[model samples]
Target: MKTWKVLWRVMMVLCVCVFTVNIVSYPQPEVTEVLSKYGSRSEEVRQIQTKLKQWGYYFGSVDGIYGTQTQDAVIKFQKKNGLRVDGIAGPETLAAIGISSSSGSSGSTGASTSDVNLLARTISAEARGEPYSGQVAVGAVILNRVEHPSFPDTIAGVIYQPGAFSCLNDGQFDQPVAESAYRAARDALNGVDPSGGAIYYYNPVTATNEWIRSRPIINTIGQHVFCM
Candidate 1:
């Protein structure tokens, strides 16, 4: 009886050791970072909606609710910005939209450094020989297209839209950007509308497209004509 009791106690101890080992070796589930996904309701969502609306990505009412409309807008923004099209406002997406995820507030309303550079490059390519205001007018037309319902809702989108800009195909876009183009881009981003809210512009002397020539002219800057 004594031996049996001792053996039973030893087995119990071994069983307890095995159980502890199992507990220690078992894989824990990965902790997923919480993100503003569909159905989430908060001020962050409202900010996201506001930014999207301002950038012409979202058309829904800013009600702070993450519904289908918000998700679809997020997807559209993501696709336009070359982000993962998950439709969830994750940290990356929030940062891309110029919003702080931790504070739930917006960052600077100005264009990012990359945006400025792109706009400058485009201005340099399209209007390097024109006056300073003319270069800014070109940038303004690009920004106007971003806000227009008929064009893509982002600068890069509008600039790179197939057959949108002739410079993209004529090798001028790849040339060194002019120094004044940078200032012009910044001025245009800062709400300077030398284009007079025009969504289109072209050099009448070089433009051969009849469709573009038919656009109602808004203003003339240097060699280019700004149009609606």
Candidate 2:
């Protein structure tokens, strides 16, 4: 009887050890990092809404609230871009939308990183096939419009102004941005007026507006004629 008891105690100890080992070796579930999702409200959410609205993805107001509407919009954007359709604005989604997760303030030009990204996207959309100098010139024309009294004073305002850019309506603005366009945007913001101080530019071969053609020509770069 004493031997049996001792053997039983030993078996219990062995069972306990096996259980502890299993507990220690078991795989843990991955912890996902969520940047924005439903019930989240912040400046980042507002920026996301603004960008989606600009791209014609979200029709709701930019109230900074990540509700069902916001989630639906994010899902749509993800679907269009071939991203994971989780309806959560994770790092990848934020980066794809041209927004930085960092809270860094605007640059010396009083333009935030998003502004540079928007300008770069515009240059990419409008002058993707143009020469490097022409790309910079396109960015310069947009910046000039921002400074001109007749146009909006803000970059977003000027870019989104009704009928300002044809690319915005022709679906070209939604395409991927070119790498050169980023450099052109930065140069244009730095006051590199490759368009020769001209506030307007258009491709003569494709330009349909007689008024734009009638504008006094200032410089010619690549296929675009810069005008005032």
Candidate 3:
């Protein structure tokens, strides 16, 4: 009987140890990992930081690192926008923050057909052979300039303003718009400004305009330098 009791106690201890080991081996999953998380670093995260700061949800620097502060800001934005509040910049969260994943109805400009066609043609002419983001950035610069006090308040006015775009004076702006240019125009209208609110962009290699070179640069994309 003494031997049996001792053996039973040992078996119980072994069972408890095995159970603890299993518990530790498999932990719970995180909230979500679609867009970004704590410790993530990328350009997308940097853009997210900038947008959140612009909208007053974040006060941290616009660094590409996604740390505790970025996560906190994301949570606040999600809460304010009635998202899942998982503290992750997923597709829904990003769209609500003025960044859309696909071409949807998030931040549409609601302009007429004439305006879109003109912008599309301008984008195709100015940003031809550039990356898709660069194309969108070009379109965004026009939109940004339209809102700036220093530039014309209308799309046509900005595009037609003397000495604003080389393509306009070089007859390139009259070229037929490409399919990609149309998509880029729609994206820009939907508030997808990859230039981060830049009002101008110029190619450093081919541009001879010294006056444009003197503007404060905001960011670079493909072969263009976006400026404020």
Q: For model 3, state the Cα shift of residue 145 in Å.
A: 0.8
Check candidate 1 and list the clashing pairs. none
In candidate 1, what are the lDDT values of residues 29-83, reduced to their tens digit? 9988878889999999998998888767789999999999999999997875556
lDDT, model 3: 0.80
Those runs of model 2 whose alpha carbons end farther than 4 Å from true positions after fitting are 1-103
Query: Which stretch of 10 consecutive residues in model 1 shows the poorest summed lDDT?
Result: 101-110
Deviation in Å, model 3, residue 10 alpha carbon: 99
Give all candidates' CA lDDT scores: 0.84, 0.84, 0.80
> What's model 2's lDDT at 16?
100
Worst 10 residues of 3 by lDDT: 99-108
Clash-forming residue pairs, model 3: none
Give the Å error, residue 104, model 1. Answer: 18
At residue 162, what lDDT does model 1 achieve?
A: 68
